[model samples]
Target: MTQPEVEPVSPRPSNLNLPNVLTTLRIVLVPFFGAALLVDGGDSGTWRTVAWVIFFVAMATDKIDGDIARARNLVTDFGKIADPIADKAITGMAFIGLSIVGEVWWWVTILVLLREWSVTLLRLSVLKRVVIAAADLGKLKTTVQGLALGLLVLPLLDPDLPSWLETPGEVLFYVAQVLLAVAVALTLWSGAEFYRGVWRQRHELRGSGKS
Candidate 1:
């Protein structure tokens, strides 16, 4: 008896879904967020606060869109690509804006951005051949980075604030700096791990092919 023919499975069509919309919205907000942060040379307390709110909203949408996509099975290629780009764009803006304002050092921003974009590009390049899930270290790095950036985005240390707030604001500012240090360390470590995973996986794939 002859076996029946099997149809090759076609790729699912990308839809104009809520997750993709949110991802696009995030990218659109990046320039606005940067503008708000840089207003008055990042010295205006009001504008700083506004920028913080915008950053918060953008980050919130990042989480919400991922959750909704996973829950509703709305994941698509666009979401996978655009989502990370949107994330890096907003965070990159924050890092550059903060450095411009003298809140963060130029070297720190340069190192972090280099690591971030390098990792992002490498991952995208090998995405078709290898899949690496988010590790706990990466999650921790993101959380710390976001908290540090968000706190620094606030006008906490602005000298124009009330005298009563001066001490607390300074304290918070230092705290944020400490968190940023930790975040940078985590970022480098996670990047190393990711590269190692890719190397190991590719080696294993080559070994299997040889067999």
Candidate 2:
């Protein structure tokens, strides 16, 4: 017997949605955030506070956009492409700007950026072939990185802050540094895990092809 015709799949959601708008907004904010962070050679408490607020807003939108997209079934190719790029652009600016201001080591920023971009590019290249889900370690890395960067963006060591804040601010700065160190470790580990996952999936595909 002949089989019945299958219904056509629904078209993808439009790219011009709130989620995408938020993602684009995050990208647009990168330069402004960097400029604020670098004001007065990174010594302006007020500007640093402004930078921190921008960063926080950008990061908040990152989560908000993703949640909105998923909840409303508004996922699209544009979001798939722009979401990660937006994230990297903002965080990359923070890293580079921090290094420029001597808040973070140059080597650390270089290493993290290299890994982040390389992995992002590779993932996008294989987007059609591989469906590697975000691993727990990767999520942890993201969380730690965001927390560390956010804390560092504040003018915790600005020297011009209130005397009462000196001790607490100093403590927070050191804690942020420690979190950054942990984030670096997690970043490397997650990168390696991602590569291994890609390799295993490709190997399985090859093996199946031979059969």
Inter-residue clash pairs, candidate 2:
none
lDDT of 1 by residue, 59-177 (tens): 99999999999998888988888988999999999999999999999999999999999988888888788888889999899999999999999998898999999999999999999
Model 2 alpha-carbon drift over 4 Å, by segment: 1-8
lDDT by candidate, in order shown = 0.93, 0.95
Whole-model lDDT, candidate 2? 0.95
User: What RMSD does model 1 have?
Assistant: 2.6
User: Model 1 — TM-score against the truth?
Assistant: 0.93
Residue by residue across 105-208, what tens digits does model 2's lDDT show?
Answer: 99999999999999999889888888888899998999999999999999999779899999999999999999999999999999999999999988988888
TM-score of predicted model 2?
Answer: 0.95
Model 1, C-alpha of 46: deviation from truth (Å): 0.7
